[model samples]
Target: MAVTLADYEKVVGPEVMDEIRTLAGYVRHKSLQNINSTPVGGGVAEILTRMIPLLRELGVDATWDVIKGNEAFYAVTKAFHNALHGHPETITPKMLEVFRENTAMNLEEMKLEGDVLFIHDPQPAGLIDKKPTIGRQWIWRCHIDVSNPDPAVWEFLRPWVERYDAAVFSMPDFAREMPIPQFRIAPSIDPLSDKNRDLEPEVVRGVLERFGIDPERPVLTQISRFDRLKDPLGVIESYRMVRRHCDCQLVLAGGGADDDPEGAEVLREVEEAAAKDPDIHVLLLPPFSDLEINALVRGSTIVFQKSIREGFGLTVSEGLWKGKPVIGGAVGGIRLQIINGVTGFLIHSPEGAANRAVELLSNPELCRKLGENGQRYVRENFLITRHVKDYLLLMLALDHPGERVVRLAGI
Candidate 1:
């Protein structure tokens, strides 16, 4: 069943719904087409899946399209992804050639038809080349932490990125010193979505039992793709460290994106590291397993997003929304989500994560306080309604470039 604005109203309230509708009215005439590498897996696709429907419900013409990529092309993009996250990956000339060829192929096949062409991440950023000829407002939304991206990779993509009318990033620090206008629009989660929606105690317990996780035992989970940047191995290490003091189970659960070719290899590595521990349940969940994921997070005593690098970890917010005190690495968007001792604890090492995990597990009162604070924080800042408002405001701002105040009629 398609979710309506009324459905979201129940989660975000009337004031927020009213604001979204008002903003949508300003840009309803303009068509929005979101282009990314994969239509499944990763936060970008998950967000667009939930967002587009709501945008259209508000009378805005919104559509989504995915750029096609082969295995080799995806491998190159995966390397680019790692490098953009500040990982040391050698960018070969052949890799650059592979990217260009695949992007060019997509460019020829895709229609540049939207009034606002929203290109997401570096994968389909090359699509911006047609902006001049198509005469449309192109906005490159970078969903990665490129503040310290590999010089070679950044240089290669910088020219293409600068051709856009404006650029949007998850954080101000992720922004580059580009000529185009830059905006910081944080990513958000749909509170009403299957992944974050409220679940019955029985349903949560059943899902846990099915996964062989004991409901009585304290559950520590990290729901993300099996990528090195997410540091699945490090998460296991943290679980082992916590095991010495606490009698708890760790759930490392996630699914791979179609655009990410390195998932299988990383999964194998994680499995091998977790094989010795019976309590460490490594799950490679299939796509659209939002209900299971929701159960895993909701059932867990504590949530972990021990990412070495991240582009605004949505899972952190998802955990927080479920009222779980998330212990995340002090990096990238995780920094923005976890407010040290307020919402959740921010850790730099597996030892640090484990230390926090034991503390929270032992003290139920502190956990409840942090969880309550985290949930309220997410409601105030990081929900789908707020995300839509930012985009709508940006579209309106584009109409009056360089203006200090964007005066919308009848507001």
Candidate 2:
């Protein structure tokens, strides 16, 4: 069931996939190598998994490699993540040492030869300093919303970020006033990926029953890493308020990542909060449980990606792609996803989320309408083909700057 370029033609016509092939020809000669911290877990890994192969299909010499990092290194990077998300933390000398040591380790082993070297997130930002040594075009792709970042942490990472040939962010607001040319490229979900493909009703029910969830009850589900920013406990509280009015069940299912150490602590806290509620089903799935997660989301009456801060909660698009209405927090790219009662509702507090959830539960028509609206919206705006097209355009933009007349398959 691995997706090929031709497979994309099924979801988004041969015309669209053909256009991608034509655009890929523009940059087929140059090499593209993507470097990030982990090979699994988190949005970056998930995106690269689907994007790499499709790029190669278009005849681009693209490859993906993961950086080596230990527990201490990830711990520092985790704090760096939180800080960039607007939770300021004191960066210690020990943490700096750990980051540098891991960066050096990766630098020694990794082959820095791609014509376009794409570095993702803060975990491997230090690699930008080595760009001069390799003399290749480097692009720093920031997936976090650093609009109001921790001052100290932003200043510390700014110099390394400035060194890149260009910087790409999810939203314009997410970008800072840096000298480097900045571009906004939102993340996307692959419609043909295991996590977004169509699932049989029996399979959905089986997964729900396996997790001790009642298939008869209307399920409100949230599938994300057990990270604090995802606000899993807050989701439980919101579901509690909705339960007071409607007899709906809640499911919080996610797995841990190697780069995120606090997932265990957050999962434990969520468990304690949902302990008294027999209706709340908590599932800590192991890695590569895409089919199971897909089934869980597909079976839901409604979905939630209630992150306190998000880059682009692909979970929102994943739910929408499955034709389920998503209630997401109004932050970062979440704002870009929700069209205010059209595609889905925008929630601020638990009361807001509860109100929308209750409304959706009360009106089956509204839920169906929103799902229809969102699925179409995503089809036009947020699929893997569009994402690959944008990246290819970025490569072209970087290579041939300021050309009035461009070329493509009439794209």
List, residue by residue over 1-411, the lDDT tens digit for candidate 2: 667887888888988887888888888889998999899877789889889988998999989988888888887988888888788688987887888788888888888878999999988888887877878888899988788888878887888899988899988888899888888898888888789888889999998899888899899999988988898988999999998899999999998765455788898899999999899988999878999999999989999999997777888988888888899999878888889899999999888999999999999999999999999989988998999999998888777555655654543
Q: Which ten residues in a row have the lowest lDDT in candidate 2?
A: 402-411
Count of clashes in candidate 2: 0
Model 1, residue pairs in steric clash:
none
lDDT of the candidates, in the order given:
0.91, 0.88
Model 2, global lDDT: 0.88
* Deviating ranges (above 4 Å) for candidate 1: 70-72, 256-277
Q: Give one digit per residue, the lDDT tens place, for model 1 in 186-240.
A: 9999999888889999999999999999999999999988988899999899888
* C-alpha-based local distance difference test score of model 1: 0.91
What is the overall TM-score of model 1 with all chains considered together? 0.91
